[model samples]
Target: MTGIAILPAGRDDAFEQYKQLIRDRHPIEDIGSYLNDEDLELFRTTSDDDLVHVWGTSVDGVWRNIERNDIALVYHDGAFVARGQVLQLRHDPDLAEYLWRKNVEHGRWNEEIPWEYMAFLTDIEEVNVDIEEFTELVGYDKTYRQQGFTRVADKRLNQLSGEESVKTVIADLTDAGEHIHPVGDEDDGPTPDLADQLQAASTDGNAHEEFEKLVAKVFSGLCCAADWIKREAYPSPSQPEAGGRPGLR
Candidate 1:
């Protein structure tokens, strides 16, 4: 399922980074200078266009579900200022260091937090979407404010779109010439107390087993072609295979 990613760029430094990396396109030849041979090759293969923009985040876990073709909404000030489609994603600290050097110069770079999770984007469009209207369409609270890199799950989008395609709903909402009908709040009501239910579920003896199954399910969806293997069969970097270096099978 295609998803939507909200990227917050309201902070002064973040906005500057956005202007440099996202608003303006960079030639692959120019960016290639900062990448290693392996990364350069990977970037070249994934990006068919000569010019592209890179968006990165230091936050963990938030980017795991994002995939190619996901819509990226760039939020700044009180509105969404830009939108684009993610073409490629990578986690390369070396490349990120070069791209966000201002963070380093400002002494904001830490070994623990690095802007390494990247999304290469194409077909970018400048947009003007007020937060209130956007939140209404997505079924979020009218006062909802994006705090960080956030993903609106496909399930949530599917619920909001009903029979219509999520992509069509997103396109219409973001299009300047289009009009959006506010989602009805007739079903909205007092929140239900799930404390007892959560406590019972958390105390289940098979919780760990259930978690393992859930992890496997998510990973299977992410990499359908990946081979399932036992932990013993996984190669360690220190122990290379007979003919080749250690790597996933």
Candidate 2:
């Protein structure tokens, strides 16, 4: 089931950070400049224009439950100000430090635990839904105020039939029904062609090279780990089997 994560973008400093990171999208090149090779590669695999946001270790437990395609509702000043679909996640303190070091230097953020847990998001849109209406929709008390990052409890969403996800409920409340994609309904049109290509390649004389390419393609598609996969699959091009690698670069 697709989950919904409530991200409290508090007033003042926190809100300012939200505006800088989530509201105003950062250039990928700017972001890439700060990342180490490992994290930079991960960053590149996301949708070209996705927004990447982060949460500190305080919400690490809650963040773990947030999966790909989950709805992330940004709350601030008694309303959901924005929403987006999660595309990928990473836990890298170095990258986080680079992104939010300004806040730390200014004493706004805790230096002890940086916002290390990153979430790459797409389909982001500005929204405005009163807390009362939002709480009622999600089965929270009308007076409830979110204090931290959290996944809406399953019991609150129990009213939804098995096929329905949190995305459906939020869409209805915000009149964004047209933007909701059904849970688990990703477009897989290219999967068959990829499989066919892999099969044909496996029968070629260079079985080792074909095998490595197959692994790279599969991992790249599955987890957006194309760079990491290529690095491991072709660590040194000096090997005869690593010659003429295609489709990865």
Candidate 3:
């Protein structure tokens, strides 16, 4: 997969620094010059790498005063082969393992994130994950893509907070006769206790009525991440592997 590595008009050394840092974690100028008047907070490399590359997703407004926005590393292979949020990036082994499991994300992410992910971020603060740090950990966890889904499912087991909310939304949708992807053993395995808990929570009859409102809230981040990679703003710089590569997506 490919993405445009925005060159700040002419900062060649800065660009080399960008590539070298990604390749070697060497120190480089944190700032660089752009075309007249507009200095760049960062620089770009000569080309985008096939295996990995870091690119700006959205810039923060305040950083806009001096280039604010979140930028993150994107993965192409391994379990974490999914389009990810810079904020979501973490060094925790467990979370890293979880992310690696969802990398390809049902094979729907070979395409870049849609521009829509850019819609909700209000400022640069939202994009603050350190790209340099994130890139270093890209494929640290060695599992294959199947692990990503397993991790998400495993996460469900201990999700005291999100499950009730998910169950409420699911129950509401089920009641409304609204068609949604059925929560199957494939992803949401049968857990009688979880089901019982879900049933107890379903007492609120309006959950069905509030379905749309609920999806709007709970699906915001997930959908935004999906939207970002699906849009034109994130096209691969060159022709992508048709149907995408395996083991990742």
Candidate 4:
């Protein structure tokens, strides 16, 4: 099984309301089909078995490749803020009402797009994965910037399983509350600051040029040494230029 990282927004700062709905054990499904007893029951049910729901138009292919036991990682701001497993996935347009549209005024639905694939994520575990460690292990550098769920690479997935920090966080999954940690906070030590610094450095305009320059600087001495050895071993057939070695300008 693979893993996906998703970003959930709260109607532009209505996160508290969204949290309340999730805490109430609501399915977040559209209520248009209340005529169906099964749908109503699902809407009313409070037992999620630690599952969370994630959906988006961009996740159609992602959910297709995802299986029941595949991992789901959540990102907020710049952190890998939570983790869960896929319990089920479906494309139910009628259930779009179930989506939390806190940004919309009362009784309005978010019609930015039609209802798409939604994944029922269970076995939820919260974690605070630094972006650097996350990218290093997951092989995705800009996970937080992704709009929807992204498939985890197989090689990176194996590497993640062996990570002690990730294991420590995943092993402590006893409740939903455990999945949260402070982001960019000094109290959490220098991790957030370091992550921010790394992000800035990576996004800087001259990052690639600087990296190339650094590489050349580190190897220039070796090249010089090699040239000196060649010059000492053999004499030049022709005289050198006024200020440079033979065959060199």
Question: Quick one: RMSD of model 2?
Answer: 12.2
Off by over 4 Å in 2: 33-57, 103-107, 161-163, 177-249
TM-scores of the candidates are 0.63, 0.63, 0.19, 0.47
Query: What ranking emerges by lDDT with the best candidate at the front?
Result: 1, 2, 4, 3
- lDDT per residue (tens digit) for residues 1-249 in model 1: 668899889888788777777887666787776666875676576556766688888875988878888888999999999988887888888878776764322224556788889888866788988988888888898788888998996667888787445655776777721122222222121124334444554466534333323333334444532221122132344654465222112
Query: After aligning candidate 2 to the native by TM-score, how far in Å is the CA of 57 from where it should be?
Result: 5.3
| Candidate 4 lDDT over residue span 129-151, tens digit each | 65566565456665435455566
Q: Considering summed lDDT, which 10 consecutive residues are worst modelled in model 4?
A: 225-234
Summed backbone clashes in each candidate are: 0, 0, 23, 4
Off by over 4 Å in 4: 5-24, 27-58, 101-112, 142-145, 159-249
**Each candidate: RMSD to true structure?**
17.3, 12.2, 21.2, 23.0
lDDT for each of the candidates? 0.67, 0.64, 0.24, 0.44
Error of 1 at 80 (Å): 0.4
